[model samples]
Target: MTVEYTDCITLSEETAELAEKELRENEATRRHGLQQVRDWIVKNPRIVHCRDDENFLLRFLRAKKFSAPMAEEALERYLLLRQSWAAAFNNMDCTLPNMKHLIDAGYLFAAPGRDKYGRRWIIARPGVFDPHKFTNEDMCRIHGLVYETLLEDSESQVRGFVHFADGAGVSFPHITLFTPKEAVRIVKNGERTLPMRHKQVYGINVHPSLKYVLDFGLSLISDKIRKRVKIYSSMEEASDEIDTNMLPKEYGGVIPMSEMIEKFKEELMAMRAKLLSHDEMKVRLEMFSEGARVGSVTALKQGSALTCGGRTLDTTLCGSFRKLEVD
Candidate 1:
């Protein structure tokens, strides 16, 4: 289930009116009062209920005549409380109020469940909020927390783990609507290089909706892969090709002499189509080799073929005796 930041921050009219009264009295007191309100709401036995309309909470908060700073502070506290609530609900079993209040207001769906111990839980699926309303970074954090919550609460539900393909973006499992930055970190750190093992649990299954969001999020990140990086369609394919030197220097792949020469040629071609003079080419080629004569093309060619350089290149073309103008 997904909850928007705005939805989480919504305040009931009673709470809002109380907050407004505090704001009117004193500025410092108002900020503290708002924080107290958030703490109270989280500690309260009842989940906040909205009467009349779903936006009743939002309206109540808006009606408050707080100074801009106070309003912002209150809003910040409200958001923090909501985040805390989400974290708590995900990690621990707690009595949740009737979700129908949120459903009636059009904020979420009521897909409820129970843990192995028969403790009740509710999944908060998002309502009609615009997807673009939140930044990707924000979505990533939210998804991370949500995933952690689901994992802690329903340990039995996680069925298996899967490796993300090279250049493939993955979201945290459990929640399907947002991409997880942790996924990105795992890939970048080469954690996805090997198959990840997941414990088979009774109730765990990947959410279909989360898969959709992950696919989109992955597309966004994959699009950023440089032309130099090769993206594999699947983990199997990536594994088959990946080697200690599979990644680029930027990613810690040890560039071989052959790859360096090819890169040099590509760069040279971009600079000018004409072939480099024998001496000049030898000098540049030596940059990828050990100590060698700068003026001798024959030595460069022979050295390149001998080393093989951990990369597959057709050195024969550069090795042909006819091409070398041996003095």
Candidate 2:
């Protein structure tokens, strides 16, 4: 039987039990929390424009362990980061030629089935892409597209997911694709900015020379995120941490990578309109500025220091790559 793509994600009995136990999520709690966050959004005037629908708001709530206050903060940051970082968040249309090209290369894909632990696997193979043709920004956009699609499923939002960076054929050109600053910002944002319950990060088949550079990037992230990272010398070692059966055949699973890539492509095509609709979600910084009387729209556009909507924004809340992209 062929697996058809659908937005509704089903969790296994074990995974559902885990969610209730760990995430404090249940039918009753979910209903109450949804209303709580929804009401909070209505009361919070600074949160001007956003996808206030229950599905969208639930992502942040789940990521922040169902805490209304934390979810509000995260949702605000999510909007601010999208507004501030044009390179990554803007133009998230999946049908664009550039995005389709990246998808064709299997640059990054979330596998079809859940692992033994019921967590999703996002396999990233950077070496497959032509570094000369695509810049780091293109890669960032691809990541945005993949994660956006993945986050649609409640399983991914609650049970969380694991990232596998396959370094089988990574070369110097691939390494040079990212500057030191871009590398740091990417690491920082993955942990600090993006609202996802990222469980573990495992790297395998890594080249010896790139280990130091990867280590340097890892050091910039928080200790919690850093500790979730585990690098293995071979697939056998990685299998101890991950269920290889769910990965593509090339990586020791039964399914072909091409099959996963094609399925993912179809999924993206199916989700094109919804993904494009993300462009509609924007944060009216002016409303925030008016409330705080911090800056003008002109100042916000001019990249006023730590100001959004003319108000002082916590530097850490906003993932401005340029601000963090330094030696």
Which digits, one per residue and each the tens of the lDDT, describe model 1 over residues 129-186?
A: 2244433333333333323233222111211121122222223432433335434432
Tell me the deviation in Å of residue 26 in model 1: 60
lDDT, residue 203, model 2:
90
Q: In candidate 1, what residue range of length 10 has the lowest lDDT sum?
A: 274-283
- For residues 1-327, write the lDDT of model 2, one tens digit per residue: 212212343555665677779888776777777777777566544556678676677788778778766666566656666666666677887777888888878889888888767788998987787888887778888998888888877667877888888888888888787777557656665665577888888898898998887878877877888899989998988887677887899888899999998888877777777777877777655544332222111112212244444465553332221111112
Best by lDDT: 2
Name the runs in model 2 displaced over 4 angstroms: 1-14, 176-179, 236-241, 286-327
For candidate 1, give the lDDT: 0.29
Query: C-alpha displacement of 263 in model 2, angstroms?
Result: 1.4
Q: Local distance difference test, per candidate?
A: 0.29, 0.71
